[model samples]
Target: MSGTELMEKPAAPAKLGRAIPPAFQGKQFPLLAVIVFLALFPPLIQSDAYDLGLLNNVLIYSLLTLGFYWCFALAGQFTFAVFGMYAVGAYVSVWAARHLGGFWSGLVAAVVVTAAIGALTKLAFARCSEIYFAIATMALGSLIVILFREWTSFTGGYEGVSDIAVPSIFGYQLISGQSKYYLGLGILAVLLLLTVLFFRSPVARDLAFARDKGPVAAVTGLKPVRLQLMGFAVGSGIQGAAGSLYAHGSGFFSVEAFNIDLSLLVLLMLLLGGMVSMYGAIIGAVILVYLPEFLRDASKYAEVIYALAILVIIVAFPRGIAGLRHTLGRLVRRA
Candidate 1:
């Protein structure tokens, strides 16, 4: 073929066959399926308030873990400020709701304030090494926890803030366990959808490049610092939202709820689930949350067994449970 003709020629059509829809491709189908299951779950166990509460916890922790995934996993920013952001979000939401006269206002205030704080924190430590940045954020988080503990007039000290306003929509209060569970599930579904979209977008690719090849990315016109700052802000904002959800749903919370232990537990969840996988965050949160309950009968051995189980999982599947599928597929192909 002539050069110009070849350049202008349309590609030959392939044989016609069924094509998978975009929604069913990659991880989208599985995410949709999970959402569907969660949507139906409340009706299946509506009578069990305890189980519903546990489900709510799963949803909440999933959000928190996803935030960690965004910052540490996606953007390569090691930060221990998750719980601090969570506490700030919760307290801010409560304060806003009391003064601003609505749950929506409080939630908005939480997300905005935490996002700003997150961005500022990143900017302030923009030049620090990863380890130092982590240390700085951790110290700041601990300081926040201490502030909340000592601020009796604000956080209610050790007693925590009580009589938190119930979250409502259009005059309808989410008073029942089922209602609260569905609310959390809906928020999670929306965020998961956004995350999926983000994963498919060019921005995610650029962020990944920046994270894995910082100096090279900067040399090639990618703004690594800006990307990391945005990631940190968004991630922190998500944590803040989770915190607001927790405060409103529980109607009471203390600084103890957002201590350093909570931050470490979240980090463990992220590590155990597979840092790079968004689904891993959800899987990790669910497993870790339920594992303790399952081992409740073990009593004295529970802690030991828990530690052993985590160690085995980490050692055997370093990439996490979500990565297990990929390993299995590789083995199948090799076989």
Candidate 2:
């Protein structure tokens, strides 16, 4: 072919050519190691129902991360309402299940109701920008918590609602703390898979696009208001689902459990784990959840330490677990 023709046509490859994306290369060993360690965790710990119960609490927080991951990580929308939604879901489900005579219906109702509440709130705040969104959610959450706390007759005041039922999936009920731990672990696995897969879809891309500025999103022919609404509603729904699980798991529900502190804890989970990376959420969940256990008699102090660690990590290693790994790699090289 002539030079012009050859250049225009494109050159042929050799006899064989192959392409592989190394970014998707296997990290099977690291994953396997993590799984093995977690699987052996109960054995390494006290193994009694009390300690296992505490660990189950950690798993519940992990589930909370899975919910916040949608709003905090994927969509970059921060809401202080997540824990409120979580409480709403838990109590609603328990109450519904007890009254409705089945756990299935309660679970469905919990999510639906929480979503409705979240949708209304998001629509109300759709006009606001980022900091405003957080402030609005915080204010709404505080209001909700107060309602639950002061609406004594219904929510049982500071004492919480007790004797609530634990859930049974396909007739296999969680009879003990260890059993509940395994069940929570299973549900968590399902949620992780769904979030990771969902992250690659157009829906996720649309949400991310809309997060920058509402006007920009409007100009792009995207409904920023509606997108934020959907994310807020869905994220709240997930929190509710986690709440449902927690209510049954703990056999109780209280305003204190799902108050603003829990909201900050969720945020910490996002930051410590690196909100952009799914692994970051999981890492943050594990650290924050277990740190209290290691604290023993002075767990409140451990929380202070955890907060300090989070600030340091955010300032020094914004990339999360992946970032820390990169830093360690450089240090190893220098050494």
Best by TM-score: 1
Write model 1 residue lDDT over 1-335, tens digit each, in one string. 11011112344444386553322235464756665585666646556878888888988998899888878887789889898999999999999998999888999999999999999999999999999999999999999889999999999978989979898988999999888887888787777777776665557667777887889999999999999888889889999999999999997788888877877888899878876467777788889989999999988899999999999989888778877865667778999
Tens digits of per-residue lDDT for model 2 on 43-71?
34667877787677767777677678767
lDDT of each: 0.82, 0.71
lDDT score of model 1?
Answer: 0.82
lDDT against true structure, model 2:
0.71
TM-score each candidate. 0.89, 0.80
Q: What value does the lDDT take at residue 110 in candidate 1?
A: 93
Q: What is the Cα-based TM-score of model 1? A: 0.89
Which runs in model 2 stand beyond 4 Å of their true positions?
1-46, 213-216, 295-308, 326-335
